[model samples]
Target: MLDVLSEGFKEAKLKLKGKAVLNESNVKEAIDAIRKSLLEADVEYSVTKNFLQRVQEKALGQEVALRAGKGDSRVAVSPADHFVMICKEELEQLMGPVNAELNMAVNRPTTIMMVGLQGSGKTTSTGKLAKYLVNKDKKKPLLVAADIYRPAAVQQLKVLGERIGVPVFHKEGADPVTICKEALQKAFDLGCDVVLFDTAGRLTIDSALMQELADIQSATKPDNVLLVCDAMMGQDAVTTAKSFDERLSLSGVIMTKLDGDARGGAALSIKEVTGKPIKFLGMGEDLDRLEEFRPEGLASRILGLGDIVGLMQDFQKVAEEDQEAQALKLLQGQFSYIDFYKQIEMIQKMGSLKDLIAKMPMQDMIPKGANIDDRELTKVKAMIDSMTKRERIGQDNLDRPRMARIARGSGRPVKEVEELHKRFTAMRKMMGMLGKNMGGLLGKIPGMGTLGQMNNMRKAASQMGQMPGGLGGMGDMGSMFGDSASKPKPAFDREKQKKMRKAAKDARKRNRK
Candidate 1:
């Protein structure tokens, strides 16, 4: 989402490389790069200025630390790292020191009022929020359709509520304020713990709409009044947030459409302008795509360092149990085409492959001009599906005739099928080697216990290895780690080492002859 900002940070880091300290003379170009990046990302001018000012003040005065090198390679903390650290800290501070938690009423139903401008994704966000509450917080949320002015708004809310398995409360032809007030009572009667009132919005801020929202607010007395702003709206979203906060005194903000080609300026600007914390982010159209806003996570992402914790959270939501089992199978070299297909399914459940890769820490390692097409996964699945049960379970079962038959069934070339089989076999072999080495390392560690007994720890390591490229270029994990594991290794035994050295010397002498 903040691709521009990420690129900017990368350029800034490059400019600071080889420098010893973040002095004013050396950091000016880096600061300029950051300033340009923030502006290009559509960040509010004043906010960008203040953010850069803080980064400069802190970076220019910070002391650079140096440490001992490994194998004669110097390991000093470069100016780039120091400057980047300062920027990361400042960005985190700018977005948040505190995450705005939902303040639900203890004794009674907590009414949440959703307000925003037209086309800002208020209705969609309302559905997403309802799903989040029900699934994450275990709250019986009653979705109230009070956007009576918009055509089919009520119907849309109903459809969304149905999709998420949440109930919707809508009174036909009733005023929004009245509908909201009645919805509150309905929630109480239905034993719903939360009532989300989706209030109507306008094309632009008008007194009539603001007054109507104010009346609804006065009637419903919502526990939380959240303004849903479009991240793609940039500074306009910030201005809208300020106006809404001034009129309705919003408790928090929800930035929507963050998964789109948004510059991400609104998310960085709204909180600073309106003095309201962003509580949730609408990442996608899926009812389950709303995520709690974490400043540190977003800041880390903006700086090109992938959000590993956020990635794990996504994983936990989809296949936590299956992942554990799969990791064991992978470690034991027991995974087959069936297991590979299941892993692909698990990845699909997590989200888009591109989005998943963006969360990884090694974006630069991605080959230039290379695109990660999720369609590739679907194609691979199709090829696997064409195979017979025995062939899928046993690689040796895929003879020439069987490969040709499978290729015809999958609408692919026989060569492609053969390539897939080769890649799959290589991946299995590499994973087996990695698992054995890791297991041996663990077995040697004092008090760590046997590798077999440490299944949980092994699974955790396997999960880390299961990144984009780990499954033999399935994602992009292969690009980061390469095929180094598959290369032949020198013998570690002293006698074997001596023999290898003598053989190498003899080979050189033979070449000279």
Candidate 2:
């Protein structure tokens, strides 16, 4: 994740806090933070300079305006919020307006030649791209093993092709250009809708490599020439893109290893430096993890508002229609350990838990750098497996004797088992309250009600199985092993709760004026 860039935006926002309007003095301090972040992220010198200049111009003297709310409820938003909006827009303008589509939309048997520096994850990206097209676009793809220089490159492509049920076209002892030339006919013969050429790459850009790539381009004339770059390369990735674009005339870029702690400068710099869009991002090693890059979504995440739309999209991808009905049942307080087990499986397919939280509007509430112990999911599963049939469904009383019996069977301590039961009971109680007045809870959160609002209530409700309290109170409704304990717990004694209710009632009565 781009933690560096996100941290910079957060610091900039903090610098502008309590200010009535943007001034040169305050704006300079905020922009200095951004400038330092961008440079530290390895963003190109010229691109960083130009981007900061644009942001400063837009933010200077900007005025806070009342949010577009109805009646007397409208309130003025802060100037820091206005500055973030400007930054998000400028960031989007810098990276995109991307056409995330491959050239195969109109062209039949579309040929896409993959090129990049060696060790840039080009071969792996080619395989992932094929799987993505097949899954997302219902494409019949032909993978051509044209990277003859690398050892086992052809075999690697063959393995990937076999795994995905896509055909691999390669000549056992031929040059890169000839292999690609023949694969074009193989695609036509096999009736493949697309052909991807996994071309040879070098340790560094060289005359020989460029000439080979140029030769393949002349012969095959691919509709899309994508350069797969490692996002961890930072500034070097931008340089690599420039060199390849000069020789091969690239159509797009696929950034790989974005799941790692890449500074994110390369992703921001490539488009500005070389005028190419990053069409796809390889987030993880999972074959299904290739994602279409969204500039506005990325920009919003950078500003720490989180992308609720993106979060729902991811939820929809891993959830089936029937699961929506099940989720509705769970949301209505008909939860069970069986349902919890299924959700754990669904979330495992969704990738890292921390990344999922980053897309949430309330991510800041969770302790930063909290080491989430995802292995706890497996431990929970083991504990559940040891439960009796009745206990697996729901336990009327999880007494110490039963917990000790289950802990012994699952090879876990009694304290661990008791903790798991406590979490489940807390969740069960919360869901019961939620099923009664989720709407009221939605309206109570300060800024989040607007930021995390959704048009599709069913879609949002369906995500309850994947996550709890999708609307608000995200810090308290945490992952199975998240560090939510680090957050301050509220005093919830009966008298305290009664006093809080009275305070809320009095505040509402005062609002009538």
Deviation from truth (RMSD, Å), model 1? 7.3
Deviating ranges (above 4 Å) for candidate 1: 68-75, 320-322, 437-440, 445-472, 475-513
User: How does each model score on lDDT?
Assistant: 0.81, 0.81
Q: Tell me how far the alpha carbon of residue 451 in candidate 1 is from the true structure, in angstroms, after superposition.
A: 20
lDDT of 1 by residue, 1-513 (tens): 677788889899999888866788778899899889889989999999999999888887766776545777867676788788888898888888656588778989988999999999999999988888887889999999998888999999999988988889988878888898888789888999999999999999999999999999888788899999888988888888888889989899998887775378878888787778998888767676778888988888888888898898888877756576788788777889999998888888777777787788877665533456677778789899998888888846788999899889988888778767766765676566556666766877555446564665455444444333322353234433343442335657998889999999999999999
lDDT of 2 at 307: 82
Error of 1 at 424 (Å): 1.4
- Cα deviation at 109, candidate 1, in Å, is 0.4
**Candidate 2: count of backbone clashes, pairs at least 3 residues apart or interchain:** 0
Q: How well does model 2 score by local distance difference test?
A: 0.81
